[model samples]
Target: MSTVLELSDVTVTRSGTTILDQVSWKVDSSERWVILGPNGAGKTTMLQVAAALMHPSLGTADVLGQRIGSVDLFELRPRIGFASTAMARRVPASESVIDVVLTAAYSVTGRWNEQYEELDVRRASRVLAEWKLSHLEQRRFGELSDGEQKRVQIARAVMTDPELLLLDEPAASLDLGAREELLQLLGGYASSPYAPGIIMVTHHVEEIPPGFTHALLLDQGKVAAAGPIGEVITSEVLSGTFGLPLTVDETDGRFTARAADR
Candidate 1:
């Protein structure tokens, strides 16, 4: 399978502190990956690199066949969709849900002109519908609940038909029911042949949707384990990665993790 993302000796430092240390990893076009790590593990940094939002300080990073640093990020960015709480706040609160999604096609966070093509609107509507936000198309972006807003952000990410999609903590602020609904939607996308190579970052195993094939575990900015989900997401690895005794279970392609009671 072709490599969709590649990182060779990648390191990221900020304010003289190492955020990601010599992380070498690859995501092939055929697999969907989950990045699991506790807070401050540099999972978001890794996603930023994959999304072309940041460059490695030490080594080479490539996405969708283009090396970071050498390519025009403006052109490459549209080909890689990124959705996160951080990104959601960047969107204008006044924009309509449909326009918020449509702006992605032009790589703009806020709508400036109301001249979107008919086909673009059609595509945006379809994406929103798939994400279960069709009824909120005309609602103000800021008026939606956290769960609803998350779905809209995800729909916006796929608006440009990206080659790689990065979703950071998609289930973070949602309640159990909303999280499950979002997970099912993500699972459906994960199994789609036309879906982009996906990398989702989360701190909890329960947040991993079905059909995700690989896992990358990070601890204190270092990779603790990386491989097939069934291999790397074991109880032992989970315990080590979080620095606590934990049990991980999987059934019917879904995963769950819990702390081992003392």
Candidate 2:
């Protein structure tokens, strides 16, 4: 499979402090990866680099075969599907659900006076149906439940049929049932051969969708371990990444982690 993302010794510095330190990683078109790390561990930074939203202070980042510094991000960004709280904040609260997904075709947060073709409208409806948001098409974006809003955001992200999908903390702030429902939806999407390469940043192991193929553990802005999910998401790695003793368990391809006994 072709490489979707490649980060070679990528580093990001802010205010004279390093945010991401010499992070080297690669993602291929056939793999679905979960990024696990505590807050400030550079998970978001990594996604930002992959999404072409931020250029690294040092080293190289290549997304979809285009070098970061050498390419026009406007051309690159359209090929990448990115969903994050930051992106959500830019959406007009009163935007209708269908419009939310439809506007993605133009890479805008709100629908303007631009005329949409019939094909675009059809595509938006299909995406919403895929995410189980068809029933809420007329509802205002802000009126939906948290889980519904997240699903809508994801639908909007994928509406343009991107080659690489980046989701930062997709399940953050969700209740148990809501998180599980979203994970199940994500699992179904990830299992599809037609789905794009996916990189999801999440704090809780339980938030990982079932069909995700690999895991990357980040700590102190560095990769602690990265490989198959079974190998990279061990108790020791989780403990080290979180800077605390953690007990981890996996059953039926789902994972859970918690503080280890004292």
Candidate 3:
């Protein structure tokens, strides 16, 4: 299978503090990966590198078959979709849901004076409808609930038909019902043949969707485990990654993790 993301001995440093250390991993086109790590474990930093937003200070990073420094990021970015809480804050609140999603075609967070083609509008509508956001097409982005906003962001991310989709803590700050609903949607997307090679960062194992095939466990800027989900997401790896005794469970293709009894 063709690789969508490839990192070899990747290292990221800020102010002489290593955020990611010699991490190496790959996501093939046919697999969906879930990144599991506690806070400050550099999960977001890894996604930023995969999204091509941050270049590694050392080693090679390839995204969508394009090497980071060698490719024009401006041109490469459009082919990679990213959804994160940080990105949500950057998008204008007053923008309409449909407009917010459509602007992604031009790689902008907000609408501009440029005319949008009918085809693009249809495509945006289709994606929103798939995510059950068609009813809120005319609503302002900020007026929606947290769940609604997340769906809109996801719609916006997929608007460009990217080859790789990076989701950073997408289920964060959501209520139980909303999170489950979103998880179901994500599971459906993961099983779809047309879906992009997905990599989601989350702290909770319960948030992992059913079709996620691989796992990457990060601990203090280092990889504790990386491989098939069944192997890497075991209790032992989870315990080591979190620096605490933990038990992992998988039932009906959904995962759950909890601290072991003392």
Question: Which candidate comes out best when scored by lDDT?
Answer: 2
Please give, for residues 1-262, the per-residue lDDT of candidate 1 as tens digits: 6799999999999999999999999998879999988899999999999999999999999999999999999989999888999999999898899999999988888988758889999999999999999999999999999999999999999999888999999999799999999999999999998888999998888999999999999988898999999999998999988889998899989988888888
Q: Mark the regions of model 2 whose C-alpha exceeds 4 Å error after superposition.
A: none
lDDT of each: 0.93, 0.94, 0.93
Q: What are the per-residue Cα lDDT tens digits for candidate 3 across 136-251?
A: 99999989999999888998999988999999989999999999999999999999988989999998999999999999999889998989999988888899878899989999
lDDT of 1: 0.93
Residue 104 of model 2 has an lDDT of 91
Q: RMSD of each candidate?
A: 1.0, 0.9, 0.8
Winner on lDDT (1 vs 2)? 2
- Give all TM-scores, in the order shown: 0.98, 0.98, 0.98
Candidate 2 vs 3: which has more lDDT? 2
> Residues 1-262, candidate 2, lDDT per residue (tens digit)?
8999999999999999999999999999999999988788899899999999999999999999999999988998999999998998899999999999999988999988979999999999999999988999999998988889899999999999999999989999999999989999999999999999999999889899999999998888999999999998899888877789989999998998889999
Global local distance difference test of model 2 = 0.94
Model 1 Cα shift for residue 62 (angstroms): 0.7
Task: Look at candidate 2 and tell me the lDDT of residue 34.
Answer: 96
